[model samples]
Target: MPYIEVIHPDEAEGRLRRIYDRVTGPGGQVDNVLQIHSLRPHTLEGHMALYKSVLHHPRNDLPKWFLEAIGVLVSLLNDCSYCARHHAAGMKRQMSGDTEKYEGCLEQLHRDHPGEPFSDAEQAALEYARKLTIAPGFVVVADLTPMREAGYGDGEIFEVNQVAAYFAYANRTVTGLGVHTEGEALGLFPPDGEEWRHG
Candidate 1:
């Protein structure tokens, strides 16, 4: 159980209901994270706004799916179960609801080191996120070359790095707050063609 009780949309005030509608009305449901945030509706609104601005920025070339994959990888590397499960559920959604691929990626490092088995690009991004997460002080211009060679420009690379960093922030917040799910949802990535439970 979450340290704070989750608030259902119907149970929310008008302000939070608006946030819930915006988040869910694109044929998607409000996720558990937001539900937890509903405990403080105004803060949820601000957080969602920032998240949407970053996610839907017009110049971003990397698909949301790939960004989410990075989120999962970073969360797992950090050993944050709450974040890991959250991003795993999102990646599971991207894998077209395939459990095998979803679970398999969970075990893979996704970074290319010597003898590492991942795409050159995936490796680059993974290495970047890991370094940023584990040792933010050590990142340099040289660290970005591989990603550039793999076709990411400065904006995408910055976005990728920021997303990785933000997820770490998210991990700390959710974990520190003792956020949890009711076990009704299997992972962050709910299976396709299945209804994701609402608050």
Candidate 2:
């Protein structure tokens, strides 16, 4: 249960109701993360917009699966099981039914020190996410060398940075609020299946 009383979708009105409607899917399902922000509906709108722009934007050079992996890694490092489980499921889906590969990734994530088994590109991104989440102060321009060596240009690197940074913000919000999975493992959704363009 949430620490504070959240306005359930059924009880939403006016702008809140519209926001709820936009987030709701075919089965009348809304992500728990969104529901957690129910008390501040405008913030929820901002959150969703940022999420879509970061992870679902068509121009993103990083594969969707890799972005999901970064999300899971950041969530795991923060011990935010609520976000981890949801993004792990999203990552698994991106594996194209390769359950074994997904399991291997999970094992890697669960290790005391992860990333050895992954490619340099994955390791670079994961390392960035780890540092950004756990010790943001230590991050430096040199820390991005591996990602650049892995062929990520400034834009791709920016996307990775934003995705990791967003999840850190999100994980803290969920953690500080005492939010739990609570049988809710829904992934973030894009509004109307639309992608936001970057300048």
Candidate 3:
């Protein structure tokens, strides 16, 4: 379950069918997050496009692991465990399956004691993500000072901004619509390419 009816990959047809084919994970499965957009397939297209570009694009100069950590932290702050758990698994893999290291990282995030494994600049980004997630209206340019002081340029800061913002949108969608990870293939990364590789 989902709160709303979702078209299963096997049962999908036409445009929905095509989209599902491209986004399927293990065993031709579509995550509930993606399938929930079935009735309006184009939005699914937009969502996946944004997801790929934001989290998996080649142009993102930030380390993919760091971006995944940002996603996990932002999702946790929003109380969106569905997204958090998924991203945590991905982050663990990105860190080379270092379970001890991964758990320590997560503990730091949960306790807001960011350090070790994460550089000072990374900690600043995480702090910025917390503010943006919990109080977006109150965030100001002054906030970027710490991140810059920690060594992030404006563009790298923007990557932090985008990843945090994207997770906020995604977390809300999951929480609002009651999406779950019951059958999701955890930790699957977005495909890399100029365009989706059609299957």
**Best candidate according to lDDT:** 3
Residue 188 displacement in candidate 3 (angstroms): 0.8
Query: Model 1: clashing residue pairs?
Result: 89-188, 89-189, 90-189, 112-123
State which candidate, 1 or 3, has the greater TM-score. 3
Error of 1 at 153 (Å): 1.4
Candidate 3, superposed: residue stretches over 4 Å from native: 195-199
Model 1 agreement with the true structure over 106-194: per-residue lDDT tens digits: 56744333113346776687778878888889999899998899877788788888788778877776776777654435333322222
Models ranked on lDDT: 3, 2, 1
**lDDT string, candidate 2, 127-156, tens digits:** 887888889999999999998999778898
Quality of model 2 by C-alpha lDDT: 0.79
Give the TM-score of each candidate: 0.75, 0.90, 0.94
TM-score of 3: 0.94
lDDT of 3 by residue, 97-141 (tens): 878888888888786647877889999999998999999999999
The model with the greater TM-score, 2 or 3, is 3
